[model samples]
Target: MSGIYIHIPFCKQACHYCDFHFSTSMGKKEAMVAALRKELLLRKDEFKGEVVETIYLGGGTPSVLELHEIRSIIDAVYADYKVAEAPEITLEANPDDLSTEKIKALSKSPVNRLSIGIQSFFEEDLKLMNRAHNASEAENCIREATAYFDNISIDLIYGVPDMTNERWKHNIDKALSFGVPHISSYALTVEPRTALANFIERGIVKNVDDEAAQAHFHLLVDTLQAAGFEHYELSNFGKPGYFSKNNTAYWQQKKYLGIGPSAHSFDGVRRAWNISNNPKYIKAIGSGELPMETETLSVTDRYNEYVMTGLRTIWGVSMERIASDFGERYRNYALRQAEKHVGENLLYFKGDVLLTTKKGKFLADGIAADLFMVNLS
Candidate 1:
């Protein structure tokens, strides 16, 4: 099934480690909303009449907007697309932005899922990341959100320099105690040009230790699995029937239309992304033009994408689908490459499905590339 992703590129404040497209200045919030509505109408047929099963409101922070602003965008989607009945509508929010009253109001809207950015529950961790919310807000917001919504996903970050093994366990325990159905936990990586990176260069903040990150990764798997959470993806865990449907659809290569600045859209063959600059996007859209660039995927590129995404999930890539889509040459090449990894206890074959073992999950990205078929015409 296809889905629609709406990007809200505005944030209340800049996180030191965030590299996502977002502006701390919200002067263009109103104008950007109007422009995005126009952009949605302009790209209405991108999905080619597929029934949309999901609509995700993601961004710098979608929860920062007023309830009415969110409603207006949903109203626009209804006006233009054939949305499925009881679609999984999700909005990404921060802990500080979600209050009891706000959650109560959001429950009244069409949003059925909440993805809260509760990165860490430790005050020091929050300070290091420069998250606007404190530890108390993170704890209370989840309690407040569960009161109104049953389908809730919270994000937690691990591997910070100050996050000891015991502290990491505490973070996982906090999420488990809250009875959160879904969680997306990530390791802290310092991207280039970010404030975190600069701090490291100046010796202000300690650099991230890869060994520490790897240790925490193992800890995450063991702890969550024991607590009855399935490791569906490398970075995601969920109880039965609580896995994220929208993200699953994406990993399976379903078509989705992404609206708003810096959003990416894919429809099997073509991929497009809107401009990252807010002012430029607004100006271009106001002039009745779509400010986006398109790329046509070659066969090799498509196969590589399939391998990259399919291998990351519990459901591995199918040998039959690979043979049909990319011919025997590419298929046999993949199988032969996987043989070495399989012998190393990193991957295993179940019938035709090629699944990675727990030992291989952390290195999935590197291995996906090793099997990639490059320069194929």
Candidate 2:
């Protein structure tokens, strides 16, 4: 089964570290929503025989849209695509936008899951990140949302300058108190061209310490694992049966159609992404043109993608599948490249499947790079 991801590209404000495509202005929201519906209708034949098992609304903040507007998008999906009997529909929301009434309304809507962006439960961290929601709003929204949505996931950030390990622990403890089934946490990375990066460059903000981030990651893994949440992916921990179907499909390299500006899509062999400019995307869709670009994956591109995604999740890279899918030479090259990591205890073999050890989980990306089939066709 395939999935559908809708990107809502409007936010109340910008966070200091975010580089995702979005606009703070709501001037074109109505027009953009219409364009999104039109895009779905336009792309119906692309997935003619595929059943959509998951529908995800992600972006600047899907919560920014009105209830009817959100419903209209989903309605468009159902009207055109063949959806599963009970698909997992998720909406990525922010604490500031999730009022009590909004949560209640969403609970009754088609959205079955909520991914709340509560970067931190501390006022100082909230200010540092320039998050739209304050500490009180973060806690209160989760408290109210848990009552209505059982499949709720919350985001937390770590390694902020001046943030003590004790404070990080409290953040996790506070999240657990709300009984959230899933938590997605990431280290605060300063992306280039973002406010956070500029501040660091000007010495206004302290540079993010890699050592502190690693310590925080280990603490998170130990605490969450003790609490019975599986470290299903490198950065995602979920209780059994609560894993995100949409994200899982992504890591497994399943087919998905991404709608809206700056969104991306994959269909096993080809990958495509829409234009990042909202006005341009809307105008193109209105004119019956797809404002996107596509590229067919080479054998090496497919192999590298599999290695990158496979090593990050519980399911490691399968040597047999690699040999069959790519070629025997590619599989042999992977084993040769992985020999050093295997000896260092960073990676190990479970039969023919190469998996990362606990000590290696945090460095999965770098390790995957080492095993990448570079200079191969």
Candidate 3:
């Protein structure tokens, strides 16, 4: 099913490791809300009558917005699109913004799910990442939020420069204690130009250790799986009936309309992204102009995307789909490339659907790149 992703490009504070398109300033909040509503109306026909199954509020920090501002955006979506009877409306939030009063207000809204950004449960890790919330707030918010929402997912980061295994375990245990249905954990990658990157360059913060990250990944997989969380995607673990429908739809190549600055949209054949600058986006939408660029995917591009996403999620690439949709030539190319990895035990075929083995889960990205049809015409 198709979905909608709304990017809220404002955060209460800048996280040192974040490089996503967002502004720390809230001066343009009102103008932005109007612009977002206007942009939604502008692109109402893009989905081509497909019923929207999920509405994801991702962002600079959706939690930073007022409850009324969020409701206005949701109202705009309903006014413009054909949404499903019970769409999974999710709001990405930070612990610091999810106060008791705020959670109570959110429970009465259309947002059925809450994805909290709880990078770590230790104060030192929080300080290192410049997270907006302290360790106490992280724990307190989850405890309160769980009482109001059932479809909750929390994000945890592993492999911080000095994060020990014991501390990492504590984070996981703390999360499990909350009994949240889904957990999205990722490794700490120092993106260029981020404060974390600069710290490393200046020798102020130690570099992330690959070995330690790898170890942490295994720990995470084993711990979560044993606790009955399905390792559905490489970086996502969810119990039954709780896997992120929005993300799953995206991974399955379903079309979606992305709203707001730096947001992306795909209608199965063409992909587009809006201008990243908030001021430019607001001005353009106000002027009745869609500030975006589009690209139509070639057959090779589609095939590569399928391979990359397939390798990361539970739904592995189907050999039948490869031969039928991408042609025998592309199918043959995939088989030829997969042979080496299959022999290396990093990849295996389950009757024609190629899947990554547990040992190679952490290396899925690199292996998928190797299997890509780089120069195919």
Candidate 4:
């Protein structure tokens, strides 16, 4: 079974540290929704007679759209694609958009999961992140939504300049109190062109320290594991059976078709993505053309991608599979690299499954890069 992702490229406001493709303007909301529906129908044949096991409505803020708009997109997917009998449909929403009435409405919709953007449950942190919702809204929305949706996932950010360990612990504790089945947390990162980066460059805001972030990560892992949530992926923690099916499919390298501006898609080995422009995208789709770029994966590209994603999850890269798919030369290069790290205890082998140690999890991305064979074809 394959997956489908729909990107809603509009937001209510800009966050300080976000670099994802989005526009704060709502001028094109109606047109964009139409374009998205058209795009889904246009790409119906891409998945090649496969059933859609998961449908993810991600975005600039999918919550900004009206419930009818959201359902229209789901209806288009159902009308044009072969969806599973009971697909895991998810919608990424912000706290402010999830009013009591809206949550009740969503309960009747096809969305079975909610990935809410609750960056923090504190006023100061919310203000610092330039979040649209305040602390009250953050807490209230979760409390109300939990009554309606059993499968809920909320996002939390750590390593912000003033977020002390005590505060971070409190944040995690508050999230746990909600009985949320899944939590996806990440260290606060300042992208090159984001507002946070400019503030740091001008000494208006403090920079994120790697050591502090690492410490927070350790605390997060311990806290969640103690609560019976699995550290399934580097940045994800979930109770048993509550892991995100869509993201898991992605990390496992399953094929998915991304619909809408700035979305991405994968077809086993090839990769493609739409342009990060609203007007341009709308015009192209209207003209029966895809405003995007595609790349057929080279052998090295595929191998490196495997190493990158495998190391981040509970599933480790398989030595035998690598040898079969990428040949002995690439496998030998990986083993040689693995040999050095294994000695340092960064990565360990369970039979033939090469997995990362707890200490290696934070450095998994770097370690994966070290194992990449740049010269190999």
Candidate 5:
């Protein structure tokens, strides 16, 4: 099944650690929305033969848009493409933007899922990350949102500098208290040029400790698993029947069309991304130009990607499929590359599927890199 991802590249303010492309100004919000709708109409043929099973509104923070604006965008999708009868429509939101009135209004919209950006429920952490919402708003939004939406996911971040193990546990516990069916948690990494990185460079903030991050990840897994949450992905936990259909489709290498500035799209063979400049993207779309770049995936590229994404999820890499899809040469390369990690008990086999061990989940990315086929013919 195919999906559509709409990137809303506007936010109320910039977060210290975020490296995603977005603007703090809403000056072109109206023009951006128009561009997005037009871009959807312009790209309808891309998914002409495919049924859209998910429409994910991600961003700078989709909740910043008005209900009417959000509706107009969804309406645009319906007017052009053939969508599934009950598509999973998700909107990424921030706590401060999700007022009780807004939450009530959204329950009546086509959006069925809410991925709240409640990164931390502590004032100190919130201030450190420059999150728009305070600790109370974070707790309040989820408490109210759970009353309206059952298919809800909340984001949490661990490994913030000075975030003790106890504080991390409290964050997870606070999220569980809201009864959200899904939780996506990640260890904070300071990307270059972000405020967090600059802070570290100037010794304004302590550097992220890898050992502390690893400890937080283990604690998260144990606690969530005990509380009946499946560690479905390296950074996602969900109850049975509540995993994110959109994200799951992505991990399985399904095709998706990304609309709006700085969005990326993937067909079965090629990947494309829109330009990141907002005004430029708006002008290009208005002039009926896609303003995007495309690349056809080589066999090696596809194999490497599959290995990377597959290892990060519970659906480990399939040896037989690798052999059939990329030939035995590539399959043997993978097996040989995986041997060291397997010997270390970081990777093990379940029948023909190569999966990560509990001790290896936090290091999945690093281990997957070891299995990458860089020079295979």
Candidate 6:
């Protein structure tokens, strides 16, 4: 099965810590929507006849679009591709955008899932992040969304400066009380060139403490485990039968077509990404040219990617699958590299699956990199 990811590259405001491609300007919304629909029609054949099982409206706050505009894009997708019956359609919305009326409208549309960006439950944290919504809006939007969408996921961030352990736990409990089926919580990372980074560089804001971040990670694990939520991924937790199928497909390397500025697509061996500029993307697409770059994956690149993404999930790397797909030499190297972690009880080999222990989950990336074999031959 395949998926379609549509990036709505418009936001009402820019958050301080964001690096994702988005524009606060909404002047070109209509034209951009047209271009997106045209893009869907133009790239219809890229999926190679695989039924589209998921369609995700992500980025720049999809909720910013009007109901009609959102539906138009969904309709265009159906017109171009063989979308499966009852495909999982998701739209990523910011907390302030999801009013009761808006949630009701979305429920009537093709969107079956809502991924709300609540970030944090504290007004001070929201202010520090320069988020558009306040603490009340975050809680209210979840209530409104849960009233409409059953397959709802809310995004939260921990490890922000002054976010104590107790407050972080309260955030988790608040989400649980709201009846959200899925939760994707992340530790705050200060990406380079972002306002947060600048603030730290200038001493206006304290840098994020690695120790605080690690403590918050452990708090997430214990809190979610107690709530009966599956730690299916490094940053995701969900009740049984509520895991995100679109995101799961991504982790499992399922093919998807990303339609919008800064969007990336992958078939099995090759990956392509669209140009990040909105005006340039719309202009080129309007002129019937696909503005994107393509790259074919080398053996080492593919192995490293698999190790990186797979190790982040509950599904660990498979030594046997690696042997079959990547040849025996690479497989042997992986096993040998995995030995040190296994000895430390941070990794365990159960049958063909080499899984990371709970203690090692927080450092899965480091361990995965350690297991990586350089293709020097």
| Tens-place lDDT digits, model 1, residues 1-377 | 99999999999888999999999898999999999899888888776568989999999999999999999999899899999998999999999999899999999999999999999989999999999999999999999999889999999998898679999989989998989899999889999999999999999999998889888999999999998989998899999999998999999999999999999999999999999999999999999899999999988888999999989999889999999987888889899989999999988988998988988998888889989987686
How far off is residue 49 in model 5, in Å? 1.2
- Candidate 5 clashing pairs? none
What TM-score, over all chains together, does every model reach? 0.98, 0.99, 0.99, 0.99, 0.99, 0.98
Model 1, position 30, has a per-residue lDDT of: 96
Worst 10 residues of 4 by lDDT: 40-49
Residue-level lDDT tens digits of model 4 in 270-372? 9999999999999999888989899999999999999999999999888987899899988888999999889998999998889999999999999999999
| Per-residue lDDT of candidate 2, residues 8-119 (tens digit) | 9999999999999999999999999999999999999999999999999999889999999999999999999999999999999999999999999999999999999998
The root-mean-square deviation over C-alpha atoms between each candidate and the true structure, in angstroms, is 0.9, 0.5, 0.7, 0.7, 0.7, 1.0
RMSD of 3: 0.7
Task: Decide which is better by lDDT, 1 or 6.
Answer: 1
Tell me, by lDDT, which candidate is best.
2
Error of 6 at 292 (Å): 0.3
Candidate 5 Cα lDDT to native: 0.94
- Kindly provide the TM-score of model 5 when superposed on the true structure, using C-alpha atoms: 0.99
Q: Rate the local accuracy (lDDT) of all candidates.
A: 0.92, 0.97, 0.94, 0.94, 0.94, 0.90
The digit string of per-residue lDDT tens for model 6 on 1-377 reads 89999999999998989999999999999999999999998998897578999999999889999999999999999999998998999999998888899899999989999999998988899999999999999988888888788999999999899889999989888988997878999989999999999999999888998789889999988988898999999999999998999999998888999999999999979999999999999999999999999999888877877888888888888988787877788888888888899999888877888888988888898998897767533
lDDT tens digits by residue: candidate 5, 106-172: 9999999999999999999999999999999998899899999989999999999999999999999
Off by over 4 Å in 4: none
